[model samples]
Target: MSSQKASRKAKKKQGGKQRAQRATSNVFSMFDQSQIQEFKEAFTMIDANRDGFVDLDDLKDTYASLGTDPEETILQAFKVLDPDNKGVLHKDYLADMMQTQADRFSRDEVLQMFNISPIDAAGNLDYKSLCYIVTHGQEEEQA
Candidate 1:
């Protein structure tokens, strides 16, 4: 009976690992060169001043363009997402923030830009997860 129990536990562990691998694979499949280009373009558009960074004003403009109101709460969320404390957001930072906020997300929620996901059991995001989200919406029409 003990041996059977051990086998079951091992199988469960293997299954968990497999799930993680699948999630990672799915995430990586989403990130292609074109996706990177799209992100760059989007970032450029957000940074209207061409200042190489997205400040609060730029974020507000982006929100407005999306037909969303940039309320104080939203602004605070942006600030929380901006890790560099440069008062501006980089493309990578935005991507990370978006992915981290997605559904089943284990990471801390910042802006309401993402839906939390449990795809990755780890609290932090792996590269593939980040790549997947950054490329998500843009892929369908571009391809």
Candidate 2:
């Protein structure tokens, strides 16, 4: 009974981990490692107080250090952020937007370009399919 209970608990933990990974896989998977690192650095810069999230207080502190209040125009620039109207800007959202908007080939575009699965079972790009796409400039259905 004890061993069975332990096995069930382990399975639950693994399932929870998989769910967490799936939840975040689309957050910034469009970016390469270097781009993700750069975004992390930029987020750190904007966070101001070393807190995990960015809010009005962080921006005010940044402007205060510059010896001036932020202009209305400057504030307007951030209005597009916080898409959920959450008031706080999350680092993940910042990275996702940057990757999606700045990339010439967005994730959705790439996924649509191939009839074959672009992503392998491991959730990374299927390099074999990618090479085929690059060489042929079109998808060839696999058997």
Candidate 3:
């Protein structure tokens, strides 16, 4: 084959792979209302002060409820997502964490799957909204 033809073929192959990956990732994705409710409940439980934010202490408490006693893991997880490190988790931070955890989907894809509305009409997400998207979701459906 000519060089031009070979280059075109390679590009087409790469594009095909990208499309296939997206399709595969989206095949089992969905979000339900109950999942949203569950996330809200979990967030409420973690936000002991009802300040609409969850601090490290609140996170520790939440993990304890989940039977996970990884102080280091929890701390690391928090550090990874807590850009401001205010020790309090905002909704958008939580959503980013959730997207990281999902692994199969990109952050944007995960947001879309959860039906999260944009923040301030700028097409971004806030802490609370991100929290809801990350926390809400059925395990079986995720599988």
Clashes of each: 12, 0, 5
Rate residue 118 of model 1 by lDDT. 17
Candidate 1, 1-143: lDDT as tens digits: 99999999999999999999887785536789899889889889999778999986787688778887645444556566655544445434555656666554333443333343212343332333333334332233365
What is the Cα-based TM-score of model 1?
0.34
User: For model 3, what is the alpha-carbon lDDT of residue 121?
Assistant: 50
The root-mean-square deviation over C-alpha atoms between each candidate and the true structure, in angstroms, is 18.0, 21.4, 16.2
Clashes of 1: 12
In candidate 2, what residue range of length 10 has the lowest lDDT sum?
86-95
Alpha-carbon local distance difference test for all models: 0.59, 0.60, 0.63
lDDT of 2 by residue, 29-112 (tens): 789999999999978887998979998777767767778655543334434663444333443344355457754456565545
Deviation in angstroms for 120 in model 3? 53
| Top-lDDT structure, candidate number | 3
What TM-score, computed on C-alpha atoms, does each candidate reach?
0.34, 0.31, 0.28
Residue 110's lDDT in candidate 1: 37
Compared with the true structure, model 2 gives a TM-score of: 0.31
